[model samples]
Target: MSELSKQLQQLQREIKKLQRAGTVPAAASAGDESKVRFTAKGFVSLRSKLGLSAREMALLLDVSLQTIYNWEAQKSAPRAEQVKAIAQLRGIGKKQAKARIAEIEAAQA
Candidate 1:
């Protein structure tokens, strides 16, 4: 009834239509290991899924905290090199993420 409810219903209808058409949603179609398209929402989701703080993610990505914030806020996007790093990160588990952070820190030290 409300505007938000109407929007949600419309989205549901669209999703069903896409499903019937055999089209995978971009967010759900990361099956290809060779390439990935970076998106602000995907970046945020990956970071959250790994349980990393913004600072930890920044260190892992070899970028500044401000840069992470900017990406998550959709203020700017990662460069091609950074997107490659992000794709690698997205495919790893939480334990691997921690190990990577440690590896980066050890290398820096």
Candidate 2:
């Protein structure tokens, strides 16, 4: 068998072993807090859900406006700290979002 095919078979065997051992895959093992994988589409959807403009999201996430655009455009992803912040923001309602924005503005003033 080819090296690639042999490697694939080995990986399949490892997956089966993991399944038999009742251990979840590494990708799926990230608990609730880190489970929300950052994707460009998800970033855009969250911004829309919170009714936030790109600038607003930048302020909310404490990133630059250009970073927000980069995230939405899929040209780059948020850093680990930003991803954690985004995960926290994902759970807030619109009212909470507005309140947070107000708090940020107040802090800046």
Error of 1 at 16 (Å): 34
Clashing pairs in 2: none
Candidate number of the best TM-score: 2
Worst 10 residues of 1 by lDDT: 24-33
Question: RMSDs, each prediction?
Answer: 12.8, 11.0
Q: Global lDDT of each model? A: 0.81, 0.81
State the weakest 10-residue window (summed lDDT) of model 2.
22-31
TM-scores of all candidate predictions against the true structure: 0.65, 0.68
lDDT of 1 by residue, 70-97 (tens): 9999999988778877876765679878
The deviation in Å at residue 17 for candidate 2 is 38
Which lDDT tens digits does candidate 2 get at residues 20-103? Answer: 554543343334545657999988999999999998898899999999999989898988878888877776768878888899
For lDDT, the strongest prediction is: 1
